[model samples]
Target: MEKTREWVITGADGLDDLLVDELLALGGSEPRRLKGAIAVQGDLAAGYRFCLWSRLASRVLMPLLTVPSGNPDRMFDDALKYPWEQVLRPGATFVIRSAAAKGVSTHTHFAALRLKDAIVDRFRQRTGDRPSIDTENPDLSLHLFIEAQQLTISLDFSGDSLHKRGYRLAQTDAPLKENLASAMLMQAGWPARGEGRLFDPLCGSGTVLIEAALMWADAAPGLPRIHFGFDGWAGHQAELWKTIRDDAVARRLAGLQRPAPRLVGFDADGEALACAHRNAESAGVSQWITLSQRSIAEWRAPALNSVAACLPAEWAADVTGAGQNYSVPGLVATNPPYGERLGDEGSVRYLYRAIGRQLRETLPCWDAVVLAADITHADALGLEHKHTLRLYNGALPIFARHGRILPAEPELPLAFEGSLDDLPEEGMDFANRLQKNLKVSLKLAQQQDVRCFRLYDADLQEYNIAIDVYEGRLQVQEYAPPKTVDPAKAEARFKLALQIIRKVMGLHRDKVFLKVRERQSGKQQYEKQGKAGKFFEVREGQATLLVNLTDYLDTGLFLDHRPMRLRIAAEAAGKHFLNLFAYTGTVSVHAALGDGIHGGAETTTTVDMSATYLGWADRNLALNGLPDSHHRLIQADVMAWLKDERDLYDLIFVDPPTFSNSKRMDSDFDVQRDHGHLLRLSMSRLAPGGTLYFSNNFRKFVLDEALQAKFDVTDISAETIGFDYERDPKIHRCWRFRHRV
Candidate 1:
């Protein structure tokens, strides 16, 4: 029998024309763009070529036959009439996938089911056995497209969605699907050859970077992928596929230009940076790219002379590579957070303004491209737009704006004033007066830049102790008595001092409710009821961090751990990470979506003891889109599971509560006493040459001197405390331990 071969490239609706152009570039003949597909007349070799090089197409479909039908029954009958024997063996596994537009059948599933029955019935009638359906994975995949009364059934040549490039072992929140990212880059007019730098400042998961790199290198994005749909198809052409891949490799190797544009990404989150680096390495482009953990405010444009200096070094090291570096000026591009994903509308607006201001101030000469949700926000950039193009990103309308930096605007003034002591004490009662006096003393310490300083009167009528951190130092003090204090008031003041000494140092907030509890009674006295009262109240100049003492047990801020969270978020983008005892999954969420690189197993998995905490993790994941199938959430004891689970993780966070008791685990754990055991268990699950971040809020915690023999621990407690912990910065102790391979 003579066979007819045709190439069909599937793309996002409204992008078939672009796919046609891409197919034509890959040597397809007579390409025609349909409503949702691009058809090209090609031999088997052309099919292979299209698959390897067409970045815009979702997948390449090879048509066996196009049967015409108006209704479900006729569609099924037409499907059965095809020469099934030629396409599949009697006992082979297969699956049918269908898509229906408005004018077509309203129920896509029913249409798909009918087609499935027809295929089975036809095969059954002929050979007394039918091919089995394997939806998860199938030997052969059949694709059906229905529009209006027109139905088109074809063979799925690419198999799975082309975006599953196989390099990703894990995924972070709200990952941009691969095809969508490629489409976005293509739409942005990113040049294949450039000395221009490509920057994704908010490079969550490194999707944009990897996609751009692949395009620049002219490398087939699917080369590293282990499987392709065509490999399992009945009309599979191994020789053609090899030729196509070999040709692509040859082009990539030959087209490898010297002095490729400097590709860099930066984020304020450490976990994001780590993830980006890992992803770039996996993609085989780490050497060509740079990833940094830096706030957007810290980013400075490279000097032209600095770039020229690199040219000489490059020429000395590799003259051939030097020639490749001169293609074009650098380009800075990123998809900043929109209200739907990262923050509320006001916060997102602020973030956008920050982005606009930073780019305008720092990268005056660099070309800029930004993907934003609407024209209004794009206008907020305040840069004269060279061009604006509309595109749909996951159903939301987005405008990709290209422009140069505008004239700089004056910097905004600081929002808060001087330290707590400066607060007025007029009209306060005795206790309030004492509190005001302590606030003033703390302010004085801050002004002096004392790392640790304290102020309190020993004989204050009601309370007499205050602790504060000045310039990162810790200070404690007993308040001196005011003149003429009564004996009863003195006794009360003395009791308050004893309570502070005994209980204040050991206070632990309830993870589930964010409540403060008495260590001895195990009862929560202050509970956080909702978000309204649960914010960390900052009186800015007076103190970097302050809590609403009456509304929530513990302030919404963990001042001491602020620096650590910032560090984790900076390094999070591309690394596979594990966060144990994850309260609210804040660190995990930050790392999964912060920036730098995009897309990889540097996806973070969080495990905690309480389902309540896990539920909070779920909300955090949804809040960030880091909770896809690739992200794992386990409600279990980190210690117990570390022993049982053998899966190795790249980064492990082991911040256990100071103490815990659960009937579920049949044990009560105290971090101060059990940290050694906890650290060991966590280290057991660490990948060779992996890092474990261990921290505890037990102020009096003494490291087990004996555990030093097994692990090398670097105390980072001082470095991890942020300015917010102005009062007693050493709120917790932290260490980074790496297993000696």
Candidate 2:
């Protein structure tokens, strides 16, 4: 008999519960879950068995010390007192890895260097020889975690992550890891009690099916491994470990004698199917798995009665026990593709709808789990998902939808219904110019598949107003005429321009709207023009934003900033993004969407002064399937908040008004006078190699001369404004800044 000790097992982000279940089934006691790990009391053999058989774990750690450090220096002193000769052999090469613990130091490399010094000094003080340090191939692997006020030191028992099961020699372009696959399987109830049949419609490289077969045969996950961290430990019990592993091999042989479980997989790529066949063969589970090539949109599921007939001959012949009655529909689990493309969302949505249609109509009683990264695609499925697991696959945050498939009503796609309008007569000069502008702008809009864009921007002298198309409706703005002009003449000309616009576009009177614009600053710029609080949804490149054409002087989205918004989306992935004065959080949404909709920024923080605008920002995020959990929204004065923030960001956008006065503000803001101080504070929060964009709509705004000598600033006004906004080059000025390192 061996004594019991507490052991810690670390798993993936969302698999702690599954880890506890596996640990309990493997002869462990008092299992408890942690943030990203699990703890249990087990003996030597218990730990060895789990290291060999448990499939849903990343590493198995053996703790040496756990204590609270009220002082920072005490942690280093405590490490020197720990017994290093007990498990670590003399003269053996070892290395220590450190992760930046929160509320402590932000430099992880320095912390790791300090920890190494204490261990070497301890070994030299005790023995005559100094232990060698080998980072590439170390004999012992040490882990040091310095959390807020606590310190945990442990030895890495499982070397080279347990997810590398040694069977996947060939894989698809984006293959799923083995442990994540096992977690999905357990969540779908495979081999739990009556876990019988399983199917994968979009199986790539056969990761899920092979994991399922391995679980069914009761085989060890570490059987093919040649090395572990404990191999060089002086206190390792080799005889005890061999006995435990031999018993597992005997159990695996006996389990193989029984009937095999029904497992099937299909993929559209021939090369991917070939890799799946090769991988299954390497795992020695080829006989129990079936592979096929099929397209999702064109393929349909087999009836419940004919399932057994379609299976392989060997598995189909046996209709008893594990292979029996296959009358019940089994689980369908798979991972699908998603991302942001310029004009390819329609095709992606079609693929997801096809997946939902087959699951609902062909397989009535089956349970299914699907991994999709885009929320819009998941909605296209048209099925009520009972449970959703949000996790990251590479750089993408994806949702795993689990539910029972049943028939549901499908949504019909809407199309435009209208005839082309006839050209106006030769005398109508304003109408002729409007049609010409539309010829170029409308074609560009259609090529990009965008539904909202500017059609005319004061093209003719008499009709000096901007016209924009939102979906099928129109917004017409009339700039206040010069004071010298006669009021009667100005009013009559505005009416004529309105009439021409209505005739040229074939729009009803109710479909068109008009607003009068004047030189505004501060609170007047955001004042409401009308109380028609209605909002309509419009599509930009990859984001669907809400636009109110009547309530405020300006819509939620700034049409002039379209080019800059797209640039943010292209460069925001895996970076810390910040957006100041984020009116409605449109740019923040683009940052989260990143490069089809697949990748996005690691996190985004949006700050503004208006609570009403922040509430609107929150709604805009929800429409894009984004939660405030990762994208933070704060309501505060931009200038005050900038001076107090200590966190650093990789990308920052600062777009302020030329002049502003608000009751909540400390003082009235003038961009020309306050920009120097505002920019300095914002730059202080920029991380190394980070970028900050400064933009304003004031026509007379100028960059301060002192800024050029202190920072690396480049005026990108010509680049940030798009072709539609080229007519008015001075509509806004944009500059990119960086630290002068």
Candidate number with greatest lDDT: 2
Whole-model Cα lDDT of every candidate shown, in order: 0.62, 0.76
- What CA root-mean-square deviation does each model show from the true structure? 12.8, 16.3
lDDT of 2: 0.76
Which parts of model 2 have CA positions greater than 4 angstroms off?
67-73, 102-104, 192-195, 301-328, 340-349, 374-376, 407-741
Candidate 1 lDDT tens digits, 12-47? 665655667777777787877676677888777777
CA error at residue 473 for candidate 1, angstroms: 41
Reference-based TM-score of each model: 0.53, 0.53
List residue ranges in candidate 1 displaced over 4 A.
1-6, 13-17, 89-91, 103-105, 125-128, 192-196, 254-260, 300-328, 407-741
Model 2: pairs clashing at backbone N, Cα or C within 3 Å? 339-596, 339-597, 340-596, 340-597, 341-596
The whole-model C-alpha lDDT of candidate 1 against the native structure comes to: 0.62
